[model samples]
Target chain A: MDNHLFLPILMPLIGAALAVVAGQRRMLARTIVLLATLANLGYGTWLLWLVDAEGRQATQSGDWAAPFGITLVADGLSALMLIVAALLMLTTLIYSFATLDGDQERFFYYPLLLALLAGVSGAFITGDLFNLYVWFEVMLVASFGLLTLGGSRGQLEGGLKYVVLNLIGSTSFLIGAGLIYGVAGTLNMAHLGERLTTIQEPSLVTAIAGLFLFAFGAKAAIFPLFFWLPTSYHTPPVAVTAIFSGLMTKVGVYSLYRVFGLIFPNELARFAPLILTLAGLTMVIGVIGAVAQTDIRRILSFHIVSQIGYAIMGLGLASVAGLAAGILFIAHVMIVKTALFFIGGAAERIYGTAELKKMGGLAKREPLLATFWLIGILSLAGIPPLSGFFGKLALLQAGVAQQAWLITGVAAGVSILTLFSMLKIWNEVFWKKAYTDVSQLPRVPAGLMIPGAVLALASVALGLGAAPLADYSALAAGQAFDVSGYVVDVCGVAGCDAAATTVRQENTQ
Target chain B: MTLILSLVVGTLFAGAVYLMLRRSVVKLILGLILLSHGVNLLIFLMGDGLRRGEPAFVDSVTGAVSANAADPLIQALILTAIVISFGLITFIMSLAYRANQAVQSDDLDDMTLTDKL
Candidate 1:
């Protein structure tokens, strides 16, 4: 019944509408976007407080009861994601203010950015499957606009692939939804979880599971489905790339976590071994690709694929600890990756190129920028006492506990390869003698640096706060495992004790 | 009825896979369109072959519902899917057109790896 749950979603949509109307007026657009995103961050903080106070929160939209009408549900995981997304959005907006100007900003960038936020928030909060689809479309449409904002040769090329692959993914999602509805006779996620528990058709369920995996896999950029990402993600402007790198793909992972943990737990268990194998391959292959790349942005983009493998590997373990590790790693990756991209943007701004070979000796002149970049890279390489280390530690522990030795080995190997890639960038860009004498390069503005620094700081903060975050992740994982809470929140019903008991036992164990 | 739906899905999948392998971007777009239609129809048919049930709502004056309701929810969902697919198709087509204009070729291979990276 609390109205606070809707603010994070509604405020962004309102802002987007207003910003669109204020298009081309640079100051007005920037002011509206910044105020709106900041407001979203503030409301997100308030929502976090409410979640902390109430344990979990759910709201039925328009006073309609659940199951029949749309419901916005905010549990611990949703709240955490909203907070992360809001923080990233706010910082990315500031970064954009410094990076984009004239025609670019005037062409509705702020409004589209706000729309993207609304879509993401909506996706995180929505309880209905159909509603999830709608939110996805909202996000995708905005992404389409943002990805092609620059309309460069590379942007268009990459954007075409991105759009096509994702269209197929969306189509598959629709087909899967239809099949699930056919079998279960409901589109509400909680109701589906309740009814799907007893389905006797194994093959049919497997087919549906495959569809969901394909749809989400493309979005998350896992293994064979990830070829589009490295090329395409490097094309956008820095702010666009930073936010997309930070939040969008993670939304895919989030959906995977949500669907598999809540509605398709048995299917997930059945498919864990397969997922583990793919994850191992994904990590190894992605990093190898990174190693082959000379371009800084492209290398970083490939790392995103490799890092996603670690998250999926954690999910593949299908254990509470594993899921917890996945959630924690997702948060860490969002922060570290965004910061790295912002640094890349800054480097590009300084050198007029993203090619590592063309750049050298940045540390001598821009020590502060170099320090921020170093922190991001070290954290990305999973240095101990950094956020990345704890994420991997949890995942590796889960892998060992689950007897997934191959996955553990590959995960560790990827970390090494990741270090090699980071060192390559360091040697070429930061430590080597100046190639083009960018000592005269323009100073990176405070606006952009501050956002990157905030994310860099968050990476350290997450590492220091690991214990409490891990506990929270475990609770969210518990909720993920037990469908009864979700079902109760969505359907306002109380009779599904058997499933709840099983979930509780599994989580406790 | 279900068999017919499966046939349509199979054809669509076949066409889509075939088109996806082709080098022409336009053909690929066509393949996607066929795939989308096939998927949309498959989803529509998944509702267990339209029942001989009444439409979702009944008129009080007539005291009767439509003879073949066919799951209005699925139909409505299918309509939404159609709209979404149409939008995607339009966007993809425009992208292809723009790519052709910029690269001066309809074949994807015309854009070399040297230029791409």
Candidate 2:
């Protein structure tokens, strides 16, 4: 079963290659991507269960000992991310089947999507820091392609900003990895966990941690670094935007959690003030930005930034409960946010535009679209009996427990504003009278509507079944924080001892 | 050797930043390329300064590689980084070309089609 860890990463790559071979046969390529995504979901679920039952499983490539060879690990956190990623891939691909233009389907879109899936899953499970950087590049390259696929004026303009900023972020990550290697002599994360503690220069370690924070923080679209998101996200096809909205920044957030909690647990306290301050700013600023946006995807794009603030708030809380809440918040937002984009994409189709001023009276014509969209936005705003409420409540509870009053206040204020802004969309798009002639709007196909409804219902199920997921998130947090267990599981006791001895010898020399 | 290389890397970074802040998108891509080269060199310096004609093999008796030997891993890393950056820079160049055509201007300030409120 441990061997199956590579399957998630490999399946998509194989699918991508096959899709490339099936070039020009759009049907064949789509079928390949669909089958691959379905297989991945099955594998991801089985892997999650396997990990839950058997504890963290790690596999070293080439049978080389840990710290010397690249390792792929699947603890609770990775398995959970894997499951969510596969779910998003499948749902969005299904939505794209009906919505995506024929030109996009013919232009290696399927291959790029599979390649992106491969990259994201690779980033999630890789145990080496440099390997993570490599996976990030893979993801970025694919994203750069997807962002500018149609090469329209808006797409080219948006893609330039997205590419440059993300490239800089990836370079920062690479620098961080190189410096960590210089300091610890090993790029393997589990080994770094052991060796880093042995290093005497706390300040250097803090600097490296800060570098990582900036790197991952930029990718995650934290405050002061999120300009690329709102500018670029709405320019893509909604299907492209949906997958990116679900997975991209969250990968950055996940890395922050992994790096801070597992590798830099000692320095987390020192960074907490800065992290919490950024989180609060991110929340307020993101919501304020959302309120000012008139485009459907643009408003939702800004909300992605706002939602990331809550996830980071969990990280800043620096406790197991806080981390668990953050994890749950990410899961909840991924499903709900993608659902909203799907519904919004459908709405965009009806009016032939994404501008809210051009769209109105959608409720009367497509009641089902209005219903799914309402579920999406209501959950986004943290209303009761929805996923967002539970996610926000858990975060609030964690904050109150930690006595982080200022950030807690900021979070609460942001939630109200989130509701206000989402309601703004509701008022403009549904309740308001038609901005354009509603008589001539085309029917929104079931293909576009069904995927979103599935995810919206999933959000409801997530809320009603919050207890089990919370428990699982708590479990994942426990595994992430258990650095020694991680090290021992990856590197045998003797291997860890050898690494420790080398550190001692180097220090003395 | 370390000081000289560090200075070179610093210069590359400085030049890159200056170019990146310019109005021309082509200069920005050039800046990005320079920035990547600087980082690659920085990693090389981090791997430990130059060790001419040294082998990376471990001594059988000590079961450890000689400290004086060059780190082979750093070379592999730098190679990977170079290749990745090369691909990215190529893409960014094409993207700039497309954007330039679409907007009919090389000035970064003019490409505000997507940034409007």
Best by lDDT, which number? 2
lDDT of 2 by residue, A202-269 (tens): 89999999999999999999998998999999998999999999999999999999999878999888
lDDT of 1 by residue, B14-97 (tens): 999899889999899989989988888887787746665455675566544454656777887888888888887898888888
What is the Cα-based TM-score of model 2?
0.97
Local distance difference test values of all predictions, in order: 0.85, 0.91
Off by over 4 Å in 2: A435-439, A494-509, B57-67
Identify the candidate with maximal DockQ. Answer: 2
Model 1: residues with Cα > 4 Å off, grouped in runs? A493-509, B51-53, B58-68, B112-117
What TM value does chain B of candidate 2 have?
Answer: 0.89
Model 1 RMSD, rounded to 1 decimal = 4.7
Query: Which candidate's TM-score is highest?
Result: 2
Encode model 1's per-residue lDDT on A1-509: one tens digit a residue. Answer: 87677888889999999888887677887788889888988877777677766766777788765555677888777888898999999889888878886778878888889999999999998888888988898899899999988777777888888898888888788888988988887787787788889887867988998889899899999998998888788888989989999888899899998889888999999999988887888898889998888888888899999999998887899988999999989989999999999987888888888888789988887889889998998899899788999999999999898888888988988898899998999888888998676657888789878999999999999989999889888887877787877887665566344434444444344
